[model samples]
Target: MKKTLLAVTSLSLLAACSSTQTVEQAQQFAPCTFPDSPTSEAPAWVCDVIPTDLAAGALGYAKKSAAGIGVMRKVAVNDARVQLAAQFQTDVSNMFKQAVESSVNTSTEQGAIENVVETFESVTKNVVSRSLTDSKLIVSQVSPAGGLYVLVGMDKQAYQANINEVVDAASQEQKLWHQFNGEKATEDLTNALNSLKAM
Candidate 1:
């Protein structure tokens, strides 16, 4: 059986870092940097996510769409499965950018607020049952832009929540993304993480 690309706990570390740049520093905010096939394709379960130009009014995505592509690519990427981990970052980054654009466009100053998609992968169920021993959780927040992101990832040692608790922590009622995917037809990060397996 094929494996699920994301473990989730690894993503727990994703935190809401207050803007390092000042309001004046961000004067040169350029979002439309990474440009690719506004139309994208992938596997079946998470495949049909081609975006229908969400770049219309208050929620436009051209600028941030480009930046998201760049940031996600610039992340430190390394995996034995990838012939050259560096190259893989670019390939995977492009795919992720496409997924983001297909799901949510950079139409607003807030960026693609939040996105989550899921696919039934033939992963070892045990993968979700572990935790990174020394991992810690912090942060609790509520925002108008809906900028909550929960990332779960597990390394060989243990499991961990990818996004910081303060940002997208699992609350008393529901898991992060699981709870986020409600009645709305919004972008899904679960689907993006599902395809993280580089090989």
Candidate 2:
């Protein structure tokens, strides 16, 4: 009888633990409500979470502009473009750092690494500027206070094309790669290009 009672107690404790964990996970993923929403009912997109279907997305807002709704929308769209560009720059920078660190020896001068990073950043900014023109306005909403929220996204195909441009830029940067040599440098560069394309 005692053995059966102990088994039941363990099962009950396990069930309680599982339920608690599930609740915590749900809370973690709860959508953020947009501030100053015009109505209690706002679309899921307004929650500021980028939709999974988009390759890249950003949220932008503009307070009531003296110009007009069209101006407000343009301002908001531009803001989102800047944000998306920054995000892409950050992602590429991180990947570049990872690839270089994994392959390059620690003795490589810090200044050289920094120069390469700067070059990549400059190239990324230019690429993003050209590519973001292709992004579509996914949604727009106006708050009761006249603030406008705009969401913009780049489709996967367009995003991939931009990635290719960046990779090509990297490849053409002969001076940047001249610092390293051998089959390993070539292999790491190839790997980095592949990862960028995947992104």
Candidate 3:
């Protein structure tokens, strides 16, 4: 009886240990990316880098491609889920360019651009474009600034990278703009850019 009881206990312990090990070893994965969108289970760096408010807006505008390479393309302007793309996009970009120029010590425009590239998302490759009938650049660069939510899907990595890039840029500057205390130095920096023209 004593032997049987010991055996049962040992079996239970071994089973629990085995399951824990399996779970730990399981290959965790994500999916393909579209334009301004997020992948499943956002990475730690994402939260650490981009502000939630800004990330939400940027992710809403991205889309992932079916063909691999983890490349994401933008959807049409008409099809944009987040309407503020016109305002927020430009604001984020301009801020990033300014910030990079200030900090990174460089000589050529190309070098500076490279620094900007490392710091922010590549807007050229990740844009969803449309020719507006109005003979003007609709949003120019920065989209409107506000709360934006990005719907996430499974098996998307490139899409997630796109979100990470933009969000990272926004929050990166947010930190730089702050001083010792809890002060918002660049308040509503993107607010005016995202607002409607006084017509």
Q: Highest lDDT, which number?
A: 2
Q: Count the backbone clashes (under 3 Å) in each candidate.
A: 37, 0, 32
Q: Give model 2's TM-score versus the native structure.
A: 0.73
Ranking by lDDT: 2, 3, 1
State, as a TM-score between 0 and 1, how close model 3 is to the true structure: 0.23
In angstroms, the error of model 2 at 87 is 0.9
lDDT tens digits, residue span 75-148, model 3: 42323333334434454455555554454334334543454344344442234132111211122111122122
Off by over 4 Å in 3: 1-82, 106-199
Which tens-of-lDDT digit does each residue in 1-199 have in candidate 2?
Answer: 9999999999999998787786657556454455775345555676766888898888888889889999999999989888888887777677777766665556656776676667776777776767654677999988777888999888888777777788787778776677556666556656756777776
What TM-score does structure 1 among the candidates reach? 0.21
Instruction: Say which prediction, candidate 1 or candidate 2, comes out ahead on TM-score.
Output: 2
Pick the winner on lDDT between candidates 1 and 2. 2
Instruction: In angstroms, give how far residue 5 of model 2 lies from its true place.
Output: 22
Backbone clashes (count) for model 2: 0
* Model 1, span 16-126: residue lDDT tens: 223455676655433321123313322221121212331111111112223453342222111111212222234334454455445543442232233221111111111
Query: Which residue segments of model 2 deviate by more than 4 Å?
Result: 1-32, 37-41, 101-118, 130-133
TM-score of each candidate structure, all chains considered together:
0.21, 0.73, 0.23
